[model samples]
Target: MVSLTERTRQGWLPLFVLAVGMSMIIIDATIVNVAVPAILADLRLSATDVEWINSIYSLMFAALLIPLGRTGDVRGRRRMFVLGLVVFLAASALAAASVSGPMLIGARVIQGVGAAMVVPMTLATINAVYTGSRRVIAFAVWGSVIGGMAAVGPLLGGWLVTDHGWRWAFWVNLPIGLLVLAGATRVPETRDPSAGGHDVPGVLLSTVGTSSLVFSLIESQRYGWGGSSPVPYAFALAVLALTGLVLVERSRARRGRPVMLDLSLFSISSFRYGGAAATVVALGEFGMILVLPLFLQTAIGFTAFQTGLIIASLAAGAFLSGGIVPRLAKLMPARRIVQLGLLCEAAGAAAIGLVVSPGLGPWTFVPWLALYGLGVGFASAQLTSVMLAQVPSRQSGQASGLQSTMRQVGAAIGVAALGGVLVTGLGGAMERHLPDRPDLARAVRDSAGAAIAGIREPATRAAAVEASAEATRRVSLVTGAVLLAGVGAALLLPDTGGRRREEE
Candidate 1:
């Protein structure tokens, strides 16, 4: 066994490397948001297709999260992390070089697969390496990476897309991936030594369930909700698969083979509530990544750099949260801090909804965005810490993986669901205004509410802009309200009181 002191000394290095490695995933998801317009022009993609560019990645990443997490437990998390990096790097290269839309989306799916592998393993490794107070501190650090990468992704993407090219967004990951791979060596491989073999049945059922569920959600947008699509059927199938998965997992557990996930973990109220809250919060946060930049550049006319900077302010809030949450975790109940954080998000979203003035510069959003970040920082960081705290050492890897899977699933669903709201709303409005002018109407439609907002006729343009602004405002408010529901979830969560929830 690695001595505690020796492990402590070497552990954080790997954690840092893991943090950096996982950042590529977060950054890639957000960075591509602002660049979609550029990508469309370069690759001649439709609006629906462009949305897929973002959705596909999150979809795959979310779908594979649980299975990958389980695999990390049976295999070696360090080994998985390394493999993920290599795959991601290769995918990034392909994405950077892709000359067509299909090829690009395919590459992004590959990248997502790699991300799914890396994200959970990193968290699992952290759980394996640290213990006690140090573990709390480590999670705070880990939480920072989550917020930090997301916060900065837009900024870096803006710079890369605006200055060099959109391809640079993926290209940059190559060097970062290499650096992480090199740094990973210093950190020892950590796995559940007794975690027998892989649970293939559980993996299959979960994958089928998650993939079908996500596919159904995404499919609903293009086809009308009623009969235009088979999304409902897909969703039904997914639910059935999940039911099947539960039965299989129970049988596996009864048979004494290690199940991919211990169902009993859900019996811990803290973990269940924390995981739910994390999922909802993730939906709001990642959903915004897809929605907000489009509002900024397309509707507000801000440059990509400006959009990035504005988004970075939100990151600044997240960074602020990261720094303080660990200390906050010490004094107050994490549940309370989490509630406070959710409220912050709600308030920020409300402010953004009520006060997005057209001529107003990016600074107009500073306070609210920062506040939103603060909410995410406080609530989100604690969720991870509290969730993992419930599980024993042997199950940490699985728990960590579950948390990651939930987060990614939330993100993917958010991107698709919330994004659908924007697209559908915008399309409806444009059709109402451009009756008889099908070509112009279609162009307006193709721009996805943005084209209508760009109308140059002063009266028409102002009206369209205001309408577009209202759409964005509504999205902000609705998403914020969704976050507030998470606050309520936090309230129901078992209070650890004083120190860790695990102790109580």
Candidate 2:
């Protein structure tokens, strides 16, 4: 067995390029979140429309990731990677230039398509390119970059939105994209010699099924829950599609044809457990990304930039942990390390619940958030390394795709479920306290979400809005508690910690 060491000068550059492109994608994911209000104001969009703008990108990306990952394995990881970057760059430009809400959203869907292509292939490429200690380092660095950018995206967006306007935030990607494109051209191609061509039916089933499931979850918040028409019907269709997808994959596996996601991949205990852990971890992390900034800006009355600064603590913690986890992977058993990571996350969340108060300054969020990030960093790096480590080299793409899909699915569901909790909790709290006053109640109900931005009654709006803010703060604290519980679940993951095997 040959080792895929990262000693070559040429190899490092492309990996760095891969990191940059990934940063662009992750940054864009959260960057638009903080500036959503600015987008809503500029485009005169509705809440549903805004949700689509966000959901479309994730839906398409998550839906297509598996198929694209398989395509990268069969065709060429490098080819798919560059192609994805091109599409993403083009879509970013289109998104930036949009004249209307729908146009921008259409562009975002395309951006999601492109992101779907890029993100999975990047991981496949890394798996192909590095081995041994170097492979561990590469994943650690990649994890840090991802965590760092996610943490900083809001601050970056806030500054860009506040200083140069929101368009500049998307525009910022253009130059970076072009540079990565150029750099990517110089990298060595990673091709799996035994990999087969694209699995068309598998692609259709997986993409359709994933999109349906995501759409159903996103719509659940809007519809009043009783009807079998939209929500129930959509969910039913999603289940059927996913069931059919499983059948299709099984058929392919039986016939000896490669499928987009190989069910056999999950037979590896380490891979299965690690992948599941990764999915849950993503749910907690990405969901927090959606909620935390809103908490800071809406509840604590922090400016976007100030909120960004506080969120930066998350990245700092991740950065600090990213560097430390790989060495820890070398030190402790994998299960113990994962357990420790989970404990750290729980502690961090509990700290946030205890310390995060409306009257507390932005600086107060820093330590708790950093602690959370540290746990996130440890789990993230080890999780990816462990999951991919168990996969056969030929099927690495499938493993990467499956893990990425799970992560994104977790993210989508997390935002929908947890965001729902925050919104509904706040609304219920407001209704309970202020429902007797019709005008004030109407104003509270009209606020659209946990944010009181749309409320109109000036005389009573202030007090009512304050109540809403407090409610949202309480909800956030609850969310933190729930997330901590999730961290506790990480204790059951398999012990796979050690030096990377020379054969892997």
Candidate 3:
């Protein structure tokens, strides 16, 4: 038998490679927000086009996850992971070279397809290969990469946007993707020989369902519900598609045939409850991510680079928390730890909400942001462990893909719902402050909170800034409330003891 010492040496290199591969996809999701203004100007994008750029990546990513994960299971995971990197790198080049909004948005959609292929393979590799305390550590690192890199993207995006221009933001992926390609050799290949044939119907139904749902949520910000837009119809189609998907999968499973997602997984209490918590947590966390930088740049008038620096506190806190959480894992169940982490997030965000003002120092947000980061670190890291604890290694890809889909769907909804809240609140506050100028109010809302600083008159700018602060305050409070809901979901989880099945 291989000794523990030998296993450690063999695992660490591939683990490093996989984590970085995973990081690229997660960071891409939020990195563009800080660069959106530059993109809008460079491409002369319409408002609808801007929403497509921001939302299409997530929509495609969420839609294809289950099918791709199942494909990886049937074919070979490491092969798919490598192929995905190639696709993503090529798309990055296309994105960087784009001269128009539609071209760039099309590149993002392709990037999402590649991302969906890579993400599940990374997590499934870890779940299959690692065991004992090493698995715990591997999960902590995986989770930390996810939680930390998301916040880190804005900082990197801010710097890149401020200096090299927005295209460089996509251009920057070239070297990193190449490095990951080189390191791909170290990652072990895994697949389920017994996973059986593909369920073609399940694939189509799930893809259409997830795509429609996410698309509708995305459109909610621009068109609102129940009006002349496609939002209502898209949402209805999503429901019908998803329901058909469930029926088809259950029927196939009952006959001992192939299925994309095994409905039986939900029978595992940890998977069900833990997944619920993850969804809610992502809903809150990503909204905060999308809004905070806008508030910093527009109301406080900080440069994107400066805004990124201030926001880095969240990343710092998350990384710092990663350092301690493995030890904490030894002492408590993963569920309890997740609950505590969400509580911390709720507290920190609510506190930040109370303190928004034009004159508020950038550094003032640091402590609260740090606390929120710590919360993200703990919750994100442990939730992976908790959710996958009872899952068979053969199905790890499916579980990982499903959980990741929930988080993406939650993120899409969060961006839509919270974005809508910001617009509505900003419009009302603007109306109260400048009732005679609806056009100015429309401009501020349309910019995604970017236009407030551009107001020329001192008094008009002051009113605009205050309106932004109030709207930001509302977003923060809503974020806190959503995290608190996650805490409730986490509380329902069955505790899988830390270091479960560990050696040493």
What are the Cα lDDT values of the candidates? 0.78, 0.73, 0.82
* Model 3 lDDT at residue 230: 90
Mind sharing the TM-score for model 3? 0.94
Worst 10 residues of 2 by lDDT: 1-10
391, model 1: CA deviation in Å?
Answer: 0.7
Q: How many pairs collide in each candidate, listed in order?
A: 0, 1, 0
Query: Alpha-carbon error at 459 in model 2, in Å?
Result: 6.9
* Pairs in clash, predicted candidate 2: 334-497
Report the Cα lDDT for residue 143, model 3: 71
How big is the positional error of residue 474 in model 2, measured in Å on the Cα after superposition? 5.4
Q: Name the top TM-score candidate.
A: 3
CA RMSD per model (angstroms): 2.4, 2.9, 2.8
| Residue 77 local lDDT, model 1 | 83
Q: Clashing pairs in model 3?
A: none
- Mark the regions of model 2 whose C-alpha exceeds 4 Å error after superposition: 1-11, 354-357, 437-451, 454-459, 474-478, 481-489, 499-504
Best lDDT among the predictions, by candidate number: 3
Q: lDDT by residue for model 2 over 1-504, one digit each (tens)? A: 123442254557767888878889988977887776667667766555666777778778888888888777777887898999989989998988898988998999899889988898888888888866677778878888787777778788889877887787688888888988998876667877777766788778777777777777767767745755487777777798889888988998899887777898778777777767766766666655666666565544566677677777877787788768766766786666666776677677666656655467768878888888787777777778877776777777888888888888877766666656655655676676666775545434333343355556664446555565554455456556655555555555566553443434
